[model samples]
Target: MTLRHSLLLATASLIVSATVAMAQEPEVDCDNAQTQMDMNICAGRDYKTADNELNAVYKKALEAAKETDEGFKDMGEQYVGAVDALKRAQRSWIGYRDGQCELAGFEARGGSMEPLLVSSCLADLTRKRTAELKAFYEQEN
Candidate 1:
C-alpha cells in the first residue's frame, strides 16, 4: 500500500497486458483456414504463448514488489489486502479466459476461435481488474 508498490503493480499490469496483446496476434493464414479445429488450435497456441509471457511478467512484478520496503517489512494489513486482491484478480482472469474460450469454440469447428476468444477475454478482464486494483490502491492511499 505504499505509493511505490501501487505504481509498480500498475506498471507491471500494463506491461503484461501489452506483452500478451502483442504476442497473441493471429497469423494471416489462420483467417483463410478451412477448418474450425485448425483455427482453434492455432489460436490456443498463440494464447498459450502470451499466457506464458504474462506469467513471467507476474513473476518479475512479484520480485520487484518484494524488493520494496513495504513489501519487505510487510507493514500494515492493507498490504496483505492488496496481495489478496491481486491473487483474486489473477484467479478470476484465468476463469474468464477458459470460459470464454470454451464458449467461443462450442459452436465453431476449429482452432480459429482461439485468438479471438483469448484476446477478447484478456482485454475485457484486464480493463475490469485494473480498475478494481486502482480503486483498492486509492482506498489504501
Candidate 2:
C-alpha cells in the first residue's frame, strides 16, 4: 500500500480504539461526582430510581382503587368511583411535578446546572408522592 494510505488506515484504527475505550468508561460514582456533567448524570439516575419506585407504588395504589371501584360499581354513572378519582389525581400530580421542576430549573436556567436542578426536584417530589401513596393504602390495613 502507498504510504499515505497506510498512514490513514493506522489513524482510523487509533480513532476506533479510543472510541471503544470511551464506550467502556467506568460507571460514575454518584456520591463522589466532581464535575458538573457527572453530577447532572447522577441526578438523572437518581430521578430514574425514584420514578421506578413511584411506579411500583402507583401500580399498587391503582389496583386498590380498582378493587374499591368494584364495591362502588352500583353507585351509577353519575358518581366518580375510586379508580377514576385515583387516575385523575395521578394525572394532576404529574402535571404539577413537571411544572414545579421546570420552575426549579429556572434557578440555573440556560446553564449546565439546570438539568441537575430539574432532576433533583423530580426525584424529591416523586419520593414524596410515593410516600403519600403508601400512606393512603397503609391507612386501610
Candidate 3:
C-alpha cells in the first residue's frame, strides 16, 4: 500500500481502539463520570440494581403466599386464593409504577436527561415496592 494509505489505516485503527477502551471503562471510577450521558447510564444501572432487589423480595412474598394458600380459606377467604390475590396485586402495581414513571420521564423526553429521569423514577418506585412487599412479609410472619 502507499504511505498515505498506510497512515490513514493506522489512524483509523487507533481511533477505533480508543473508542472501544472508553466504552469498556467503568463509568463510576475516578470521578470519571462528568457528562449527562454518563450520569444517565449510571442511573439506569442503579435502577436495575434496585429492580433486582425488588424481584428477589417479590419472589419471596409470592412463595410465602403459595405456602399459606391452604390456610387462606380457614382465614375466611372461602378458598386458597392468597397466591392469586398476591399475583394480581403485584401485576397491577407493576403497571401502575411503570406508567407513573413514564409520565415522570416525559418532562425530559427525547433529551439527554430523559434516561436519568426515567431511571431515578424507576429506582424510587421499585424501592417503594420493595417496602410494600416487606410489609406483606411482616404480615406473613
Candidate 4:
C-alpha cells in the first residue's frame, strides 16, 4: 500500500478502537454530549456497560448451574447441554446484534452521524441482552 493508504488504514483502526475503548471506560458524560462525536462516544460507552453486565450475569448463571449439577449424580450430560446451549445462544445473539447495528447505521452511512446510529442500536440491543441474562440468573434463585 502507498504511505497515504497505510496511514489512512491505521487511523481508521485507531478511531474504531478508541470508540470501543471509550465505551468500555466509565468516563463518558452522556448528558453533556453536545457534538455528534461526543454522542457516539456516549452511546458506545452505554453499550459496553450493558455488555459487561451481560457477561457477568451469564457467568454467574453458568456457575450456578454447575453447582446445582452436583445434586444429581448422573446429570453431567444435562449440565453440559445447558451450558452449550447458552454459549451458542450468546454467540448467535452477538452476530445478530452486530448485523442489526450495521444495518441501522446505513441510515447515515459515511456521514458524521453514522457512528451515533450504530452505537445507539448496539446499546439498545446490549441492554436487552443484559435483561435476558439477568433473568436467567435470577430464574434459578
What are the per-model C-alpha RMSD values against the true structure? Answer: 17.7, 5.2, 6.1, 6.2
Per-residue alpha-carbon lDDT of candidate 4 for residues 1-141, written as tens digits (9 for 90 to 100)? 999999999999999999998667455579888878788778877777877877788888787565555555376555445566677898999999999999999999999999889988988898888788778767767
Number of the top TM-score candidate: 2
TM-score winner between candidates 2 and 3: 2
- List the lowest-lDDT window of 10 residues for candidate 1: 60-69
Model 2 score (lDDT): 0.91
Q: Candidate 3 or 4, higher TM-score?
A: 3
lDDT minimum window of 10 residues, candidate 2 = 71-80
- For residue 42, model 2's alpha carbon misses the true position, in angstroms, by 0.5
Worst 10 residues of 3 by lDDT: 25-34
**Residue-wise C-alpha lDDT for candidate 1, range 32-59, written one tens digit per residue:** 6566555555555555565665665555
Poorest 10 consecutive residues by lDDT, candidate 4? 71-80
TM-score of 2: 0.77
Per-residue lDDT of model 2, residues 25-91, tens digit only: 4689999999998999899989999999999999888888776767666887565477788889999
Number of the top candidate by lDDT? 2
- Candidate 3 C-alpha lDDT tens digits along 1-141: 999999999999999999999778464642576888788878888899999999999998988887788666677767788788998998999899899999999998998898899899999999999999888877888
Off by over 4 Å in 1: 1-38, 67-75, 109-141
Residue pairs in collision within model 4: 23-45
The deviation in Å at residue 3 for candidate 3 is 29
